[model samples]
Target: MRLWHQDLLTFLPRAQILGQHRECCALRGLGWGKKHSTIDYVFTYSVKRLVDYHQLVLREMENRGYKPDQQWYCPEYRGKNTVPWTCTLRDELDDIPDGHIYPEHDDAYREECLANLRKKGIELFP
Candidate 1:
């Protein structure tokens, strides 16, 4: 676990090691991939400096049901994640008429859509 945490820290510089836990169920073989034992992890982070931050981002992510722990490790792709993950990202892009979030804006039309994707930390691929 220490090695794995070290590897993750390379990318997540601000990440702090909280703890790890074993999963209760064994993954079953499915079309997605071979089955394996699941391991759960916990992590925390804090901003280096104070700035504008909104709890709305967290709410949007939770509302969108982006459970990486369950989605990445679980063998069965069911429940709230029935659709392909790519499909979800594509759907989000549809909300952006101009399709850019970096250049922040104040337009109300883009507020809901932009906030939903940006606040939730969705990565856009070129």
Candidate 2:
């Protein structure tokens, strides 16, 4: 849904206006944190950032009854995810914090994605 949906990219004008990677990263962090008061205007800036990847982009769009974008990862920037960080998406389902929930699927998901990437000769940008 996201890969093909041009609206997601255009929905958050701020993303396109973001001059630096840091700025985009900052906005992404904001959206993920659910400090998302600003998303009333459109879809969501965090969702727009999905354009940077094929997987989430497609996943999001598919979730919305849209066709998945046939996007491919760029080879040049494939192995250099110098972002060196991930957004802290605290679940806003409830304000009460769930203390230290262990992620049991981390290893499995990581291994699965890595294997798929290797099979396609796509090196992950770690």
Candidate 3:
């Protein structure tokens, strides 16, 4: 369960983009605060950070003509089984520097994600 570097969102294949939405939902729901090595850093920040990241995934999905359920916008919205409209206002990261929502998503992490994707036979160039 990794949040692929945001820079790669536009280039990610459909399967990966959809899977990222699911990952965000899981993390925002029961998976919140759970310790998974690949994404442990996520738990260290405010839930808003995840929400902000998920917004990027949603935008990419929309750009590709995929209609993601709007309910996922709420930080409290889990899966379809759970209730939607739990929160109307969402938090946003202020003044994101270098176009990265998270500090950990630095140049090194971006290359790491690219390498990992290459291992899976998916090559995305920035």
The numbered model that scores best in TM-score is 3
TM-score of each: 0.16, 0.21, 0.86
Clashing residue pairs in candidate 1 are: none
lDDT of 3 at 6: 94
If both were scored by lDDT, which would come out higher, candidate 2 or candidate 3?
A: 3
Q: Native-vs-model 2 lDDT?
A: 0.32
**Once superposed on the true structure, which residue ranges of model 3 sit more than 4 Å away at CA?**
80-95
What are the lDDT scores of the predictions, listed in order? Answer: 0.24, 0.32, 0.84
Candidate numbers sorted by TM-score from highest down: 3, 2, 1
lDDT of 3 by residue, 54-125 (tens): 999999999999998987766667676655435443644355677788899998999999999999899886
| Per-residue alpha-carbon lDDT of candidate 1 for residues 14-116, written as tens digits (9 for 90 to 100) | 1211111111111111212333222111111111000011122222334445333444332222224244323232123222224222123325433443434
Where is model 2 poorest over a 10-residue stretch in terms of lDDT? Answer: 1-10
**Which parts of model 1 are misplaced by more than 4 Å?**
1-52, 67-104, 108-126
